[model samples]
Target: MPENIVIIGTSGAIGSAFTRRMSALHPASKIHAFSQSSTPTSEGNITYHPICYADEASIQDAASLAAETGPLDTVIVATGLLHEGDIRPEKSLKDLSAKKFMKIFEANTITPSLLAKHFIPKLNRDNKATFAAISARVGSISDNRLGGWYAYRASKAALNMILKNAALETARRNKNAVIIGLHPGTVDTDLSKPFQANVPSGKLFTPDFAATKMLKVLDSLSPQHSGKIFAWDGQEISP
Candidate 1:
């Protein structure tokens, strides 16, 4: 029997790319994709669930729907916020607004954390399971070289912590489950477009390329590797 997968943030570049890849790799598997927009036209093994990452009710509804279907074999959270209009100031910290920082946390950290809290319990314990969150490498305090994007960095860091803690808790009940935080590298998405100029040549990755690498990493993971943070290139990142 094929596995059941739940993909959050299905409208985003990386999320959409994963959906396409998974459709080809696991055609028999049921895929539940959550996005803020209405369902898009696609001929794949996908079920669209309209969900707003910023809304608590929408998150709960999505989780409840997943539970109703059956035990979730895998759940990949691709939701994140790089920029949120003028709410997130383009200027330095001197001009930063608390509201913008909080908004970033809501999207990047709180949203995924809430999903894990509600959905991990719905994962199948009879077999192996995986819960992966798309975190940014900038979230690693030890890896921080240049200082900028404070809100984005802080939010992702919080997400990493939450995923780690969730992994520990989930392990008690589902010993075979693997919870991980993944960084999709500098993909050519709206979130990374503005910052791509600084990226070295041949270092920037397309969403498809990043998704491929991420899937490889996910496939290689085991329960022993749970709670670890990994980059798209398959390298382990500091917490």
Candidate 2:
């Protein structure tokens, strides 16, 4: 039987790219794409659901809708936020606003955590499954050599921790399920456009490329690899 997959954050660049890739590879699979903005234009094998990541009720509703179709084999979360332009002011710890930090936490960490809480339970134990969430390299506490963007970094770190914890818990009840945190590198998207000046050429990947790589990694994962942090290039990253 074809796998059932649900993709969150479907309106973003990477999310849309993953949707297209999955459609091409598994045409018979039931693919549900959830996004916060305008409903994604549907393709032959994909269904779109409007979702608000920051809202718990919206997430629960989306989970309910997804479960109605069938048991999910995979749920990929592609949501992320980087402060773009002057929308967020740059300031040191002493000058940072609590509201700004909370906003970052809501988007980068809390939302995805909620996704895990609601969706992972919907997976079928009879089939091996994977839950992959898009995370950032900056989330690594050990790899934090340059210390700016405190809010973003901390939020992602928290996300990583939660995924790890969830993986451990899931293994007890669903040993065949794999939960992973993936870092997609610096893809060319509105979220990363403002910060790409420092990214080396060729190192900066397109959303399509990143999505393809992420899917490959996800495809390769097994329950043995649960709770690991991996980059788009297939290398394991430090937690």
Best by TM-score: 2
Where does the lowest 10-residue lDDT sum fall in candidate 2?
A: 84-93
**Candidate 1 residue lDDT tens string, 168-221:** 998998998989999998989988776789999999998899999999999888
Q: TM-score per candidate, in order? A: 0.94, 0.94
- Give Cα-based local distance difference scores for all models: 0.85, 0.87
Q: Candidate 2 — which residues are off by over 4 angstroms?
A: 40-42, 84-91
lDDT at residue 12 of model 2 (Cα atoms): 88
Backbone clash count, each prediction separately: 0, 0
What are the per-residue Cα lDDT tens digits for candidate 2 across 75-174? Answer: 9999877784344534467647787788888888899999999999988788888889999899999998878788888888999999999999999999
Clashes of 2: 0
- Pairs of colliding residues, candidate 2: none
What lDDT score goes with residue 212 in model 1? 91
